[model samples]
Target: MRPSPLLLALPALSTAQQQFPFLDQVKGWFAQASNSISSAIPSAPSPPSVPNPVASGAKVIADAKVQPLTKDNYQDVLKPGAATASPGIEEWMIFVTGGNKTCFGRCERAETAWNESTALLSASRSPPNLGLLDCEAEPVLCNAWAVGPPTIFHFLIPQPLADQSTPATTVRSFGLNRTTVTAPEIASIHLEEKYTQKEPYEGIFHPFDGPLAKAGLAIPVGYAIWGFSLIPSWAFMIGVSFISRSMMSRRMQGGAPAGGAQPAAAPAAGS
Candidate 1:
């Protein structure tokens, strides 16, 4: 039977559907399904806003910069108002840090004590900024009177580069690898083990073996061949058969004549 008009129209309709599927109202069904799914779930509340332009700019600047610290460009990060000198910005903080491992423990104890002491301020809704000093990376303020590292000293920067009052002359320090100690000193001091950074078992190799990876991967590799000969694929089998057939002919041609015999010589009288 001949095809019907409706059947002939079906192909054109399918072609048009393939070109613009939305014309077939698939998007309408999809939108309805999406709406149903969305309506079933409770609406999410709006996110709170936090101004982060300065943060984004800082990130970009940090990414672009690789400036090495030198005497010429060293800035006093400890200064309370060291960020800018535009007139009235008060940046304040209690920096808790140690110069070394021994100092680190003391600073941590101090941090715990300070947290305990400031609980009242937190309850009253007034909390101060606190920072951990990166002792090695952060150069100490040159003019501040510090006994040495591994100590807690207080400082405030009221104005930009102004002759601020001298910082406290004396500060308490933690155990600094105690060079000499009496019986009384040994009795008073405390000690404990701290191993934050340590040597790794595998050394520095990563992603693969280090240094000798090329030597390790120098093995012969192929889809249809190995070190000695072609691997047993269809192409290899075909070539081997052809060479074998030619060699077989040569072998047959070089063979001794078939079905031929010679008479034995007469035995000597001694036999």
Candidate 2:
């Protein structure tokens, strides 16, 4: 006699279970393949320096100073009102001294005069109430001092990778490999420039406010796709196996033998 549909399905059901071990192995292989693929792509290289306009500008500033700004003295020049008054100025000075170096230094005497003079100039041009008379003569001297030299203005502009020569390309390629395997050194320098112009918290806190914030948001989405695709196929296989077993057991019980008499009728009625 031909077997019922439920019985016919049993062989298929058993085959599925037997095939599970192979399926698990395949899943492991897939995971390994995915890891290898992720490892294959080389990291982006550090940006090649082809004379950045901004850095050049900074170098010009450094070159003008009598002394280069060190970590210890940076605070002196960076402070507001640093270049003011009779004794010493309490302000920031961007000066260039050597050929390509820019320095920021605190000059108590010169800065005071410079600040007072600029204030006077500002006051003279604007409303009468804006002028500072304490060191009004200093701006004139500073201006005269600034006039004698042929000041070089260096601005750092990003050098595009497409414009560089073969040697530059080779260097950049190696940098990219380092960035991929190690920390992103080149990218970090670019980030420092960005952070210098705008505060770090500004990037993190203001999502709709700036370009950096938008770029930051985009980077994580790419990572998420890679991560989810790596989930093992065995999880699905296990769930399917559980469901099939439950269904088969129910069908088997329903088809069990029913040949026994009905408990002898329980001695009912008149016998």
Q: How displaced is residue 120 in candidate 2, in Å? A: 14
Tens-digit lDDT track for model 2 on 106-147? 222232332232322233322111111111222222121221
TM-score, per-candidate, Cα-based: 0.23, 0.19
lDDT of 1 by residue, 2-104 (tens): 9899999999988988999677597788889999999999988899997567444533433332123222232344333555423443322233334453254
Question: Considering every candidate listed, which one attains the maximal lDDT?
Answer: 1
TM-score of 1: 0.23
The residue ranges of model 1 lying beyond 4 angstroms of the native Cα positions read: 1-93, 99-108, 115-127, 134-151, 160-271
Off by over 4 Å in 2: 1-20, 46-55, 61-271
